[model samples]
Target chain A: MQPVIRLEDICKIYGMGDTEVRALSDVNLVVNTGEYCAIMGPSGSGKSTAMNVIGCLDRPTSGRYYLDGIDVAGLSDDELAHVRNRKLGFVFQQFHLLPQLSALENVMLPMVYAGVSSAERRERAAEALTRVGLANRLNNRPNQLSGGQQQRVAIARAIVNRPVMLLADEPTGALDSQTTQEVLNIFSELNASGITVVMVTHEPEVARQTHRIVWFRDGMVQHDNMRPADLAQMTLTV
Target chain B: MNIIESTRMAVKTLTANKLRSTLTMLGIIIGNASVITMVGVGQGAQRYASQQFESLGPNVLFIIPGSEETRDRTFQVPRTLTLQDAEAISSQVATVSAVAPQLQTQQPLSFRNRQSNSLVMGTTPDFLSVRDFGVDRGRFFTETDVQRNTQVVVLGSDVARKFFDDTDPVGQQLRIKNISFQVIGVLESKGAFLGNNQDDAVYIPITTMSNRITGNTSPYGTEVTFISVNARDEASVSAAEFQLRNLLRLRHKVVNEDDFTVRTQKDALEIVGNVTGALTLMLAAIAAISLFVGGIGIMNIMLVSVRERTQEIGLRKAIGASQQDILVQFIIEAIILSALGGVLGTAIGAGGVMIVGAATPLKAGISTPAILLAVGVSGGIGLFFGVFPARQAAKLDPIVALRSA
Candidate 1:
């Protein structure tokens, strides 16, 4: 019914004087509800910065950001944190699962902040882990899990709160090819289940799996295009 | 976040670094233990002193000659108290139970071949009841002995042992100040009082003392060191003291400052109480500094922990943990450390007090208020010192923290 993330001419500048660097410049982007999209760019292309702004992790220097119809630019730090907890889930390249917590606890963390009851948090976290094919690895800590399993745990943590949008930053950047394919299959299944997923990736092949790709370069969005599976199949047949 | 969740997380984190946590807690433990032990010992000393004063016979009052200022300023105490003044107090003061005028001097005591420096106390027969001394084997001197100036001596229990080891001391002759005096009776053992061994002193008739040895040091009458007056009862102590002061002031005549000072047992108890109380306070204050230092130690270690766990903080924040969550986590960790240390220290300190009670004469006791205060103060110190490091951890920018990690 509404776009899950919307940014209008967002500019994020770091440092001051001659050392100033524009991490993101005049960026306008929108991802509607239930859309799976990939943001692609080289190093220093502001793709990560855009993902940060969309995820409510950092504020923009100038311009408006509406996350799930709420004005994120006007919210306080705690309010932004609540929005992150309730509306968006994050999967990092490093899997950022707290090493001290088991996979189940890591997944339950978001719901803890969401004020969910302990029993419900346990139930939902278990279900989320099962969704990521990590039901048997619930008691394993990040150190004990394989790279792919750790990534899956991180993904479960990201989606355990049933966030409106899932934001992943190079989710398979640290995994082998076989593990990367398994993680992508998980993401595909998650997107198919009606959750909007946005990922920032340096791999062209990774971007090709998504329904749409938005390319970023030199602190600006250079191109955006839809490459639906049916259209790709039609192109291959032609 | 709920407090339970934060507390659990805090406990988890602290237990993760068990050695570091214990080392951090050591300062608080020592601080609390010293505070409890010192307070207990100080209070024990006060109790022991009070008990000693109580054992000096009930409802006893001392009438010292010369004002406190005069006593301090003069080389020797002015002999304002005399046998006449003691008689006046006994006759005129209705509240007085008994009056024992005393004159003390260190004299060489000789019997056969054994010779010892003995403290000789010159007092009337009333000294037996007024000072709570009893004859163990023989009878004390009669009032007629004082009137007749009899050369009779009463040997204290220890004095009897010292001179007549296997032989009977009573009815035996003991030479004092080169004057041969007969020991009429041996006193029952009255142990040490304020470091002075009462058993080492023997009593003689006041008249005999003024006539034979250490002649009159007072102008008015037989010069006495002080008058030991027993009140009729505990309630009559103040009244007796008042009447004694009035009699002495009238007898001294035209006094700008009364040349005498009367002190009751309660007054002595209070003075000892105040001294020991102040000492206890001082010890606790000094120990409190260590608690403060312990707080600082906690702050220092927490700052280091915050710096070390930057990634963990960043991850928590990114996972939608508010700054308050981070703050509470770190603060709770500190409180847990200090609170645990406080509990442990209290146990150790109470045990130490028990050991002291068993080992020494102080009757050392555990003070509940002190234990509660030490534990409460340690917890509060944790919260106070934790704020800075927790704030530092909370204020860390997640993006920067994540980048660094």
Candidate 2:
């Protein structure tokens, strides 16, 4: 598989002088296409910072980032937004589905930014919702849907643009175990369809389900490709 | 995102908060309504004044005492016009057809037990034609009546009805200022003009009125209130006015600005139009302040809305909406609110115009250009005031926004 993402010496700093906060320090990473990976870390470990950078929500203070083989280091904010729209899909802890839009409309959003015609947007949104097992719930508002259903709609929205990768941060953190499994199953199915999935979760049980784990501590990766069985039982710390 | 898409989104968002949206539009609604109604009333006043002036009789002109500047600042008629001026106009001016020298005084008149203070107009026989009055009964007193100082009076229809109800007013005698006068004629009913009932006064000879009743005679012959002159035809009205002014100036002599002013019906109508136009402008300017205030209200509400919808902004941003898209969405929402307000206000204002037209003497109508201007201006105000708040929304940091949510 080709490398969909490569990071070289990525550093993100948050303040100046004595109050300076380094969210990421000399972070180097390479994630391949179609890889299902989990980034695990405790509080202030910079995993969220990495997610932000990888999702192109924020720019790095220093270093080069290549997404789908194109370096994103020198892109403008608008250009970066385009990259995010076309190449990356973000799923958040709260699902973040727009309350004003229906499931179908929410799924149509990225395509709207992509400037797709309404008919095409509707058709593609329906197709995406159907793939997420939400064909009958296409017109339901976010408030009208269950938590699990809302998360599915969010996932449908994320994948509607046919992005290269899915970037989820604590995606199932607000969900119960039953809904979490439903989310994990969808992620697995999407991964099997040749989409890379990078998720950040603190739960070892969740991390064990992924193919690879990158654990962070003190704004740096303490371990890469670690398996749960290789760790000290359920200590859950790197 | 395209404009259509943004507009659709804006409509959805605004509809989701119906009360807030309606409340936000209240200012624009009131502002537009005032703007429209004020302009309508002003136009109506101008029209009424024009009608009243035109009804003074065809091709009529008033030679009033004092210069134009003096009359504007004072209520005192300068007594510069008299029978002499009227006689000179009727004889010397070629464009003149008839002249009515008028003197007016409110006097107590009694026919037996009916005593009332009524307006008494003193004039010669020419008052019938120059003032567009018709004698309904008996003949009007002739010019010989003024020469003899005969105490002959013509009763207006209203005065005839008041003093001699159900009986013929002609040949009846009425006492004015303790002097007895015989009614020789009755004039036809003339409708009110500018709030004064034209058919509610009595007419007498100017010589009898000055010598026997009021006893206020001037050495300059007769001090008439104002001289009413009619041009030979409609085409001669302005020419007549120009000639009258020149002749008066020559009579008064060595004038810098002249002591008297001759004005046509058209001039009076123009003066009325200017006054009403200024009133309309003042009203519209006040209404504009409200519109400006409404625009500020929109900006204030939009700023709050941006704050309230920060999470939504963040979510949309994360989902690939650019800053420009968010900006467009908010601005479009403001425009929709304001334009809708304009339409509603126009409806209310037009209804008010119709009601005013029906209930009052003013025939106010809904002006089309005013409607267009108000609606266009409100829409423009929405766009103008919406920019800062929309920019505030578009410039929010997505990461911080999401974290707050």
Candidate 3:
């Protein structure tokens, strides 16, 4: 299998002088291309830290990070930004949509940073918003949209530049059960279309929707429930 | 992101809070207005003084008795110059074109039932050209009028109007110090000089003034007031002044400091210019303090804005923005605020200058360099003051920023 992300003994420590806290230690993980999975854990289990490192937002204290076969651990801050821009898309629990911009404009932001031409950026941003079922709400601001719709807009923004992997941190943590299902369905549809989706969450129900689950406890991986049937099915479908 | 995108975002953010932006710009506006107005008025006053000197005479110099140090110490200038000195300069100095020696006294004048205290000046026929006065009616007294000691007077316009009731004052009789004199000519209007009205004085023959009026003639060839001398041309003024000084020192037999001081129009204008220039500088410096305060106001607001928008910064960073990007965005916001303030202040200051020009005797014009300077300074201030808050915002950890909000 072609791997999309490979982590070797990653460690992240915070503070020093006897107050040092190891947020992550010896965390080895890998996800294949086009896989739909979730990283699940309790509070302080370092799943969030793992997500940050994988997304290239934070560097690990000691580790080897190979994102899409690119050695990201040795990357400088500027190079990491380029990796984040081209290799990964991020979604937060808070639905971080800039309030001043319209839904379409918010979706256009990543492509703007990607140095995409304005005409193409607009066309692709509109297409991404259409894919998220937000075609009609493209001009609406974040405050005017419902919570679920805002999350959908954020999804469109994350995917507008056509990233290789979508990394979500508690993506449905703030939503009602009905909207949670709606967002999860969108994620499943995105995965079926040949995109890798790696999600971090404490909710078992959210974890169950994914094909595989990696559980963490006390700064280390404690469980891996990768079903062979689901993997075969994922390959066959894609 | 490009500068254009950053600027666009900055505009959007600033326009969201219109009241705060306008209030922040008020200090710069007032500062610019005062600077423009004070400088414009100062320039206008200088121009007005130069015009007054031009109207005095063409290439004229005043030979005042005594040194420059004691010119203002006494009311009367100690009569060290004489009518004979003026004649000697007119005859001997090749650069000298004309010379008019003046003798002055304040005396009550009467014509029919009207009576008033008036300034009476006794001068030669050369006074007509040397003092730039024109005879509006009849004719000025001839040189024979002084040798014969004829009691003939030329009335100034205001004096003519006061004593003769606007009737032709020529050929009329007027009494000065209770002595009857015939008005042979009437002078045209000459406006105020150094706050003293030039149109209220009457002119007479210098010999008649010494013989019949003041009767203060001495053996030193008739004591007189200042001598007004006109050079042959503008190029000859300094040469004539130097020659006159040497002639006077020899005539007065001075071995130490010279007894007479020659004053040029340029010298008087320089003194007036220095005073007005200092006044303008002081006023502008005071106004610049307010501009400085306005820059501090921008910095204060930017700091508060950075704190309030921490989450936004984190979001931008999370979405592929580098630290440099965040820094540029905040810095652009501050620059937009200050540059916009500068433009608005310039418009207001130009308007104020025009208003002051319209309402007062100072015909102040809007100075282009002043506008450019004020605007450029404010923009630079925005850049200078903006660095602190922009750096602060750029340095925040995205994890902490996202967590805080």
Taken over the whole model, the C-alpha lDDT of each candidate is 0.88, 0.88, 0.85
How do the predictions measure up, each by TM-score?
0.92, 0.96, 0.86
TM-score between model 2 and native: 0.96
Residues B157-272 of candidate 2: C-alpha lDDT, one tens digit per residue: 89899999979988988998878999999998987878888888999998788778767655566788888898999999988998988888887673587777778888888888
Which digits, one per residue and each the tens of the lDDT, describe model 1 over residues A89-178? 989898887777899998998998888999999999999999999889999878999999999999999998888999998998999989
Best by TM-score: 2
DockQ for model 1 equals 0.62
Ranking of all candidate structures by their DockQ, best first: 2, 1, 3
- Superior candidate under lDDT, 2 versus 3: 2
The order of the candidates by TM-score, greatest first, is 2, 1, 3
Task: Tell me the tens digit of each residue's lDDT in model 3 across B7-44.
Answer: 87788788877887777667666666666676676776
How far residue B316's Cα lies from its native spot in candidate 3, in Å, is: 1.4
Which pairs, if any, clash in model 3? Answer: none
Candidate 2 achieves a global lDDT of 0.88
Residue A238, model 1: Cα distance from true site in angstroms: 30
Off by over 4 Å in 2: A231-238, B73-77
TM-score of chain B of 1: 0.93
Error of 2 at B235 (Å): 1.8
